[model samples]
Target: MANIAPPVEDIAPDALLDASSSLLSEHPDKDRLFEQLAISADRAAVAGAADTAVGLAALAVQVLEEIGGEPARLGTALAALGRLEYERGNPDLEPLERAADLCDDLDEPVVSATAYAYLGAALVALDRPGDALAAVSWSLAEQERVLRVQPELRPTLKPVRAEADRARGLACRALGRAPEAMDYLARAVEAALPRTPAQRLKIAEAATLLVEDLLAEERPEEAMPYAEIAITALGDGFAVKAALGRQRLIRCHLMAGGLAAAHPLIEALIEEARAVPGDLTFRAVLADSLAQSAELLPLLAEDGGERAAERGRESVAIYDELLAAGVEAEGVHTGRAAAALALAYALELCGKHADAVAPLREAVDTLERYAPGNEQLTGYLARALLMLGDALVESGQAMEAAEVLRRATELEPVTTPPR
Candidate 1:
């Protein structure tokens, strides 16, 4: 009898990896070792130890490759590793491509379908939408063939089907087939409907994509429900994702001209950001979002200027903290500049042009320091200079305003095309 490994849930991720490594060194049943490693990797991923999961999955593939394991086993290991890598935001197409090639030579329809599905997803992430479409087409066809032969596996393949559909939707969108993308994304959402708690994340992902599509098309009413669905599905456990969902929901309301509806959501997002123990990137994102809300709200509501000023101050404070912390990333500097610009705009909206001059000067100085010679930032620098000139004029600094305006006009034209 083959040696079966103990349950992964019974051990810590680090301990399981250590044990798996020790077992590999002993040369005990190679196939069984591969299975144990694969199981451990999946369990680690489920437990949110993404790095450990990728390590285990990579080890599994290495073990199989070293011993010249069967193509089916090797393909499975490669596919698992590729999937984990993609989830970890460091996608590489090599493993997934190799897994798909191996599947082509095997008779295991389910494994072939699963491998292709993962390949399609990775291709989408890598921005090869045309290739992604072909891969997902093969995956869906293979899945259909399996269902024809063994309908009983339908329940097991729901998540796989949803994954394939979502990949197809993203591929179509990238290919500029808007209507087709919407249909596929809607199907993906339906296919991902939760049958268990574990399935909720899938549903949230699909719904989020669909909402983005709808929002892009200016169909905010259609986007609202899916945005809400994504937020509800994420619940409290996935704070970052839930906050993103709220941001999307807020956009839906704002686009539909419901400033009142968006207000509470914006506040909720601020509260969530403050409550969550997130890293610098999350804080930067929250600050940017607040600045954007502050800039937009004043355009939508009569009483919004005061609220915008409040949020703008908060955004500027966060950016100031980030800068004081010695974060030197270009994005951090740009975000701080943008926060200052937004605060100035809010202050001007509140009829405080004199007060706005200070922030406008800060924005102009920041951009002048960081944006020159960078094509992408040229327009931003010019805009900041122009705004600063106007603020100076309003604050009765006519001579300074003339020089600032002349400098703004001397900037090279921003000719870079949008992506």
Candidate 2:
């Protein structure tokens, strides 16, 4: 909610409902609920608690009970609270399950449907795809049940339709069914985008996750445009966005073999690193981007990529300092990521393939430990494995090289499938 767009009154209800609050025709103090969510999200960001999201949502629920259970407030509160939990990484399904029961008690179709949307996302995150699928199905079931009993609610259907679409799409993605996922996610994006503040956030988040999956499948070209839109949508003031933007930009440039254009950005990123909180992952990503840009420099210049590589190396050194000073998991992941890329280039150029193995292996271990399930770290993994293979071959270990390459190739292909 901290970086989320402010709600606009004139937009369609779907865009409106998908955000910090939901639409309930009966609740008083509903607006206050939205404001509280915003404040809590912002506070949680700086505080960085694992349970900050749930704690904030719980507070909202307490406030709702004081408002006399206006139907409007109830639905709106449930939607907001549900979405917040989904973002906070709560996958228990119990919170959402209880929310659905609350909506059912009030006989609110719109709220009921949206609750299912929340349920679907939570189920997916928890790795219960079938249940996630069933939860969405149940949500639709509840929606129909409500509309049949209360025909008056049918008119405000756009956001509900869109919400359902987004939820279903999320389930598809979790199933690893990309084609179905793409179709559903695209519709959800269309339905929720530019309208629902919450939905747009979902669209942006989904797009980012999808692009990463695509890239992991090694389909950079397919992921490129999504990554671009995602970066733009991420706006400013969000540290994660800053890191993701540079990551895709550097990658796209590399895929296009346009190292020159990437050079200055890489330089700028290194400089940018100096000003940011040393512990932030953004600095680490900047460091890695610098390293990647440096490695590409040789492909575009006569002087070789060493200059950029050297600058990147310097940036990496700063990240090292931050880590030594007790940098968080974020710093560890990003620093490891940058170091891995830089080390690969350094070892390859210096003909020290044997020595390169240790750093590459360490990079892999560090990234896996600190940034598990993260797309960028996955990229680092791919790069490290490839480098190890290259080094093994360089050092007259063709058998080992072949084994490594085979493993890298296998790991790389599934990550980025065709759009």
lDDT by residue for model 2 over 1-419, one digit each (tens)? 32334533333323333443333433345656545554564345334432554555555665566566665565656566666666655555665676777776775667778778778877777778777778788777877786788777765655565566666777787777777877776666555533323334556776776676776676777777776666665554455665666667666656555567667766676666656764456556656755665565655553344565565566567567657767766755556566656656665675667766766666666765654576655666666678788887887889988987786775543242100
Model 2, 189: alpha-carbon shift in Å?
Answer: 3.7
Specify the poorest-scoring 10-residue window by lDDT in model 1: 1-10
Each prediction's TM-score versus the true structure:
0.66, 0.57
In candidate 2, position 62 carries an lDDT of: 58
- Model 2 clash number: 17
lDDT of 1 at 178: 83
The lDDT values for all models are: 0.79, 0.62
Off by over 4 Å in 2: 1-77, 87-99, 102-108, 140-163, 194-202, 256-261, 302-306, 312-419
lDDT of 1 by residue, 244-361 (tens): 7887888788778787777667766766677754577568767877887787677656444787888788888988888888877887787777778778888887788889888888
- The per-residue C-alpha lDDT of model 2 at residue 366 equals 75
Best by lDDT: 1
